[model samples]
Target: MTRFDIPAPDAAAHAAALERLDALVKPVGALGRLEELAAWLCAASGQVPPPPIERPRVVVFAGDHGVSRLSAYPREVTAAMVRVFLAGKSGVNVLAREVGAGVRVLDIAVDDDLSDVPAEVRAWKVRRGSGSIEAEDALEPGEAARAFEAGRRVADAEVDDGADLLIPGDMGIGNTAVAAALVAAALGVPAEEVVGTGTGVDEAGRARKVAVVRAAVERAGERVSDPFELLTALGSACAAATAGFLVQGAVRGVPVVLDGVFSAAAAVVAAEIAPEAVRWWLAGHRSTEPSQAVALKALGLTPIVDLGLRLGEGSGAVQAIPTLRAARAIIADMGLLADLG
Candidate 1:
C-alpha cells in the first residue's frame, strides 16, 4: 500500500509539560493527572514539550477479514455487534460517557454492506470486505491505502470536534492474523509470537490461525524488516489506516490510548514509521496472549490494566480510559497538604 505522510504534532506539548510542572502546586512528581495531562498536551501540540489533553476522543474501527470466514464464528456476527455498539448498548459507550469522551464508530470494511447505516455511524467502507486471504493478498494495495486515509479522516474530524485524546478500537472478524502479521513484521519475530486467541478461538482453531499466518508471510515474498512493506504484504485495511492515524495523531500532538493487540500492533508499525510516535502512545491493557507481552516489550510500554481480558473490540481500552482520567484528575485537582496552610 502507498504510504501517506501525516506529520507529527506541531504544538509544543513538551514545553506545555514543562510549564505545567512549573505551575503544579506541589513539588515535582506530586500531581499525577496534572503531570500526565501536561506531558500529553505538550507532546500532542508538537511543542518542544507536550501539553495536557482537554478533551479525549474514542473511535472504533470495524471490518471483516477473509481468514475468519472459515472460523467457528459467522461473518454476520461482526455487523450485528457493530449495530449493538452504535445503539449505545455496548460497554465502551458506558465508559466513554463517564469521562465525557465523545465516541464515534466507523465502518472501515465489513464482509457485508451496511447501506442503511444510521446517521450516528460513520462509514468509510473500503469494500464489502477483504478477499479470501488463503487465495489472495487479502487487500489490494489501493484498498489498504484507502483504509489509512479513512482513519486519518476520522482523526481529523475528532480534532475538529475538540477531542484531544484519540482512542481506537477494531471490530473486524479474523483481524488477529492481520495484527500478528504486522507485529511479526515490525519486530522481526515469527508470526507465532504475535498470534493470540482472539474472540474465543479454541486450541485447534488457534493452531490453524497460526498456520494460516505463517503461510501468509511465506506468500508475501519480502523481508519482514521493512514494517511498511511488510504491512502492505500482511496488513489489513483497518490496521493500515490505524497505523497512519497513530502517526498522524502523534504528529498532531494528540495522545492515543492503544486498546489491544490490533491497536498495539498498529502502534508497533507507527513506531517503525516514526520511532518517536510511541512516546505519545499509552498502552491500555494486556491482551489475550503472551505475544502481547512481546509486542509491548518491543514498544517499551506498560499496561495500566492487567485483567486477563482479550475480548478485542476496543472494550479493554475503553474500560481503562476512566483510570487514565482519574490519574489526570488526581494530579490536576487534588489539594496538596501545603495548600492547607
Candidate 2:
C-alpha cells in the first residue's frame, strides 16, 4: 500500500525542445526517433536541452522464483549470474562499460546464502526465494512492502550518487514465467500470448510455462486490479523492487530506461501505482518477448531500437545508451538554423 506522488514531466520544456529540434540545421523530423528522444529527455529533466548523460547506472535486481520448473535453466543460475555480474563478467557489464554506465546487482530474493557476498548487494534481501506463484503467493505478508521500500532506497542512493539515467534490470531463473503471469493478469491477456521462450525454453517448456502462467493469473483473479496485490500474488521480490525503483525514479525526477520483459512487467505495475511516472520512462529496446510488446503498447511507448534483443540484465538498455547520448548531443550541440544568418 505504498503510494508514490509522481509528477508528470515538464510540458513547456518538451515544447521548447521540439521547437529547438525544428530550428536545428537539419530537415524537420529528420532525426526521426532520436528527435523524439531528445524532446523526452528535455521534458523529463525540465531542461530545454537536457544536460549530457554523464552517469548512467544500471541496477540489476536478482532473485529466484519458486516456479523453477518453467525455465530451461535451474533456479541456482540466478545466484551464479549475480556473481558474474558482480565480477563484471556478465553481458550487462560489457555493454554498460561500452556505454559508460555502472552496474550494480542486488540479491533481492535469490534462494541462496549469499552471506559471503558484499554487504551492499545483499543489504536488501527480502527472502530466500518467492513462493511458487502457481500454488502460492509470491511474497509473504509485509514482504512486498519491504522489497518495494528497498527499491525506493536504491533509487535514492543511485540518484544521490549522480546517476543521470537509471536502467532497471532483472536476473532470476523462471522469472519470465513470473513476469508473463503478472502481465497476463494485469492486461487481461491469455497466457499463451504472454508466454515466450525465455532462457531458450523448448516448445514443450513454453507450453508448460503458458499453463503455469494461466493458473497463476487465474489464482490472482480480481487481485490483478490492485498493483501491490497483483505483485504479491504473481510477481517476485525482484519484480516488486523493480516497480518501486521505477516509480521512485519518477518521484525523484530522474529518467529511467526500461529493459526487457521483466522490467516492462514491473513498469505495468508501476504505471498502475503512478500513472504519471510513465512520462519519465523510455523503452530502451524492443525485447523479443511477446509480453514486453503488450506491456509497452499498454504504456504507449515506442522502443528506441529493435535489435531482436531478448537478453535481460539490462543489456538491451545499455545498448541504447549511446543512442540516448546522441539524442542529447543533437539537442545540446547542434547548430540552430537561425545562427546561419
Candidate 3:
C-alpha cells in the first residue's frame, strides 16, 4: 500500500493562463482545445505561460501475461517488440523522434531471458510473466508492490534527469485483456463493454477475450475496491508499474500524456490510488477501445485528439506531443492584445 502525496494543480496559475489566453490577439475562445491545453499546462507546471516541453520522455513497460493465449499474437511478441523499441525501430520511436522525445524500454515482466539485451532494460523486472488472472492472481504476494516501486523509481529518475513531460507506454501480448479486466473491475462494468478487438483480434478471439475478462473480473471480486489488490488480482506487472509511474509523475509535479487503453486502465487504478493525480494527466487521444472512453470518463478527462488510434506503445501520445508544444507556444510566444495598444 504505497501512499502518494500528490499535490493538486495550481488553481491561480490556471486562472492566469486563461486570462492570458483571453488576452491573446485572436478572438476569445478561438483557439478551442488549444486554449484548454495551455491552461492545463500552466496548472500542471505551476507557472503562468509554463516552460517549454524541451525534454519529453517515453517509458515503455514490457511484460508478458500468462493469459496471452487470448491475444491474437503470441507472448513472444512482447519481447520482440521490446527489442524493436530498443533498436529504435518501433512506431513509438518514429513518433518520439518527431517530437524530440527520448524513449526507454523496461522489461517489467517479459517471459524471455533477454540475455543479450542491455542490462539496464531488464533492471526493473519483477518476474518472467504474471500469473493468469482468470485462474490465479496476476502477481505473487509482494511482486505487485515491487513492480509499483519500480515504476515510481523510473518516473523519479526521468523527472530528476530533466524530463519535462512523461508518456507511459505498454508492450505486452494480451495486455488489452488485462487492461479491460482491470477497467471493468474498477468501474463495475461488464466485460463485453470493456473488451475490444485488440491487435485486430477476430470475432472468436474477441469473444474469448471477453470471457477471460469476465472471469478475471469475477475473480477479483471485492479486491476492486482496493487499488493495489485489484492490480495484483487482475493487472500485469506492467499495469501495476504503469499505475505507479503515473502516480509518481503527478507527485513530482510533472505532467503526463496518457496513451491508449493500456495506459488509461492503469490511470484508472492510479486515480483510485491518488485522486488528485488526475489533474496532472492529459488524455493524449481517444483510443478505439471502448474501455478507454469509459476510463477517461471516470477520470473526467477529454482526449486532446481522436485519430482512431489503437496502437498501444505510446504512439498516440507521442503524436500528440506536437500539439502540446503548440499549446505551450501559443501561451509563451503569442502577442497579447494589450501589448498592441
Query: For this target, which candidate reaches the highest lDDT against the unseen true structure?
Result: 3
Each model's lDDT: 0.71, 0.91, 0.92
Candidate 2 per-residue lDDT, tens place, 279-316, comes to 88999999989999999999998888899988899999
lDDT of 1 at 155: 81
The better-scoring model by lDDT among 1 and 2 is 2
Q: Model 1, which residues run further than 4 Å from truth?
A: 1-54, 119-123, 223-228, 335-341
lDDT: the better of candidates 2 and 3? 3
Better-scoring candidate (TM-score), 1 or 2: 2
* Lowest-sum lDDT 10-residue window in model 3: 1-10
Give lDDT tens digits, candidate 3, residues 1-341.
55678888999999999999999999999999999999999988889899989999999999999889987788899889988998999999988998899999999999999998999998899999989999999998788778988999999999999999999999999888898998999999999999999999899989998989898888888978998899899998999899989999999999999999999999999898888889899999999999999999999999888899888899999888889989999999999999896
TM-score of each: 0.83, 0.97, 0.98
lDDT of 3 at 107: 96
Candidate 2 global Cα RMSD:
1.1
* Backbone collisions counted per model: 36, 0, 0
